[model samples]
Target: MRSSPDPALSASSNAMLARARTTFDIEAAAVLGLKQRIGASFVQAVQKILEVRGRVVVMGMGKSGHVGRKIAATLASTGTPAMFVHPAEASHGDLGMIKPVDLVLAISNSGEVDELTVILPVVKRQGVPLIAITGRVDSTLAHHADIVLDSGVEKEACPLNLAPTASTTAQMAMGDALAVALLDARGFGTEDFARSHPGGALGRKLLTHVGDVMRSGDAVPRVVSGASFSELMREMSSKGLGATAVVDREGRAIGIFTDGDLRRQIETGADLRALTAADVMHVGPRTLRADALAAEAAELMEQHRITSVLVIDAAGVLIGALSINDLMRAKVI
Candidate 1:
């Protein structure tokens, strides 16, 4: 009962998709080309940035300026201290931001951006090492740079082949490669990364531990294994953790009783009043170490199809309890 699409519209859609695909292919090829360009100069740039006594100052004009800002952000977030300085601003007064111990990164597709080139003499006078990212190795920026990284591409994805499309793509890819190499050289680990990104989901996953979010002390519901069913229910309700740890005489957790277990018991028509904690609790219930990551606890909860879990110490003592709500509050869920 459905009609076919109009031929003209279909042709237009196909043409648009074709152009998009071509653009991606061109950009991909440009990025792939960059892998072969990474050699002594690339290593030198990374080393210079790492050994700098002050922050890395990145400079660029127009589209390269946009890419420069992103590169500075990536470097700062990944352990390297970096900042972007506009070339025009540097020529006016922003050059004061750069110290003699700082390293300069200059970005230009053609290596001929006047705004950037005008400050090369002043940068050199300050004895700052300059690293250039450019499409032309023999260009002005490259000639003056202490280290040169080639960001050349075969062609632009623009239909006119004039605008910066594949060129900027290559530059961005090269910048990322530089940042990652610096990160690896600095021995930057997840803990360092989490410190930089302390407000996001990634931060929560890396920095938040079970102990930080778990209910402890009086907030943790606990009962001895031999405790009566009424006593277990009272502990669970009063603590409101949706689960209670049933411990041995020595305070070692041996089982857990949750609201879900209560539902299954009621469905089976078990005599609630007659049962004790030992008779109703699930033995050897899934437990999380207090120091384990909240993300790990979230995964365990998902795997076991449970809403809550008990936290234990190395001695298997019931130290704390955590429910899905705790994870939600911690933004780890």
Candidate 2:
């Protein structure tokens, strides 16, 4: 059976995508337009959350609730304590979740859910600070809130002009803007995010330093300057690091001797049986700080076209040695 085309719309092959693209562009533009809406109310909202010693309690119904959950998560991750509560569920014993020290952030496009309206009185009577995110500034929730954040959209992306498409995206983007602004104000840094994501790849990349994974001290292949080539080979073979550091009398790294050095020396007909360590060691090999990120070490190795780098402290003393394989095994790559 053949399906008939709709009589009300164009039968063009690109019509569906064209319409969707237009809708997406409009929604994206609306999100960008929200910048003009920031005012003292935004500051008040942040101040309310900052002053509260307890968690920020967010309540909403329908699409707004979904975005509220994400906003709450972002807030918690960025140094602000927050949680989402369903307004309909609050009518049940779930209202016990509310406490005096908390701030309430309510989300509802119309700001007029019957359940939310019912709870608004209790929220006001209990002295819980209320921050409202709604399309209508004069609506019931916004009128009662200590601070009102308007997430107004000219129209929804829904072709039917009813579904919460552009409206919901605007709400979510506004929530993110607020959360990020507050995060910056609170001085949340990369370390704070790393602490929250301690078990993930980002944690390993940022928190794991060269010292944590590098072959240290004796395990690092090393040969004193002027040592015989045989002794250098023995150090490299014994340590299995494929490379040995040639240190000056002060114990600072002066050069490095690697497997490549041996191959080059042999190609040049250099007497490996009689050459000293300094005769073959390459000077000014790559060196990284002990505190440098393992990820950065991996980048340097790739950029320098080498498989290893020496870890040195501020004093220029060789403290550890790292290889590409070690970082790969640790999954820092």
Candidate 3:
């Protein structure tokens, strides 16, 4: 039997849901507000990073430092070289990591964080280009920066308005905006991104080729055209490819025989024992070049509604075979 809900619990849940919705509203508005403030300073920051011969040195403190680290990673992965350095650590020997050729991107909500501000004069003395993302345009960090990006928010989503809620959201949005602008200006593409993230899904899809995933040599299931139906079945079962290729004397694929063809022949009541591979196989089978992308092989399989295809060379000689199962194992599909 079901029990009735407690009124006290119900009221508390309602209040919590309302607060959650309000937080989303506040954070969303903070991010949206950044769209209007993007102008000259933003463009200048992008241009400067593009012209730099060295990496972007990102620095911040507290919550802003967390956001800065993410920003640096995004920048690095997207083609712009970047790394994060903690502000407090910078005062104690870490500042040496910032070279004159490297540009500094400093993040602070109030722009007056002492750990961050204390390094401003030393950074300026070294003649390193500095870009500031902060709420206060009139603060000391902004005054010393070569470019200032306004990440100011109306208020925090925190009930006391003391925590870094909406403010941090605004800072991250600004960082993403800068990364995106710089990526476009540098003409960075998917292949470049994949190279930086080879362990990721897009990397596997773009960098993997048919040769990398196809079964080659003895592993491929194949039989001479004159071979008996029993020989074809044996090759198919041993290789576990669900199909077998019929090849000629020169080792070129002449036809293909699949489980489907066997079922069709049985349905027709044909004398299976009297058949040769050439007599039962389907001619004009689908084929792919070994150098072609695995993604292309997948598309070909999908287009023709087949579970496997033959891999051939420039001379159309059969060298390998690929199947849907192979693509699955490689995570190309």
Model 2 RMSD vs true structure:
4.6
Question: Model 3 reaches what TM-score against the true structure?
Answer: 0.94
> Model 2 — TM-score against the truth?
0.85
> Alpha carbon lDDT of residue 114, candidate 2?
89
**Candidate 3's residue-wise lDDT over 106-169, tens digit each?**
9998999999999999999998999999999999999999999999999999999999999999
The superposed Cα distance between candidate 2 and the true structure at residue 50, in angstroms, equals 3.0
- Alpha carbon lDDT at 318, candidate 2: 90
Task: Give the worst 10-residue stretch by lDDT in candidate 1.
Answer: 1-10
> Candidate 2 on 29-76: residue-level lDDT in tens?
778767788789888887778789999998888888898999999889
lDDT of 2: 0.88
Q: Pick the candidate with the highest lDDT.
A: 3
Tell me the lDDT of candidate 3: 0.94
| C-alpha lDDT of candidate 1 relative to the true structure | 0.92
Off by over 4 Å in 3: 1-9
**Order by lDDT, highest first:** 3, 1, 2
lDDT (10s digit) by residue, model 1, range 255-298: 99989889999999878999999999999988989889999999
Q: What is the lDDT of residue 242 in candidate 1?
A: 85
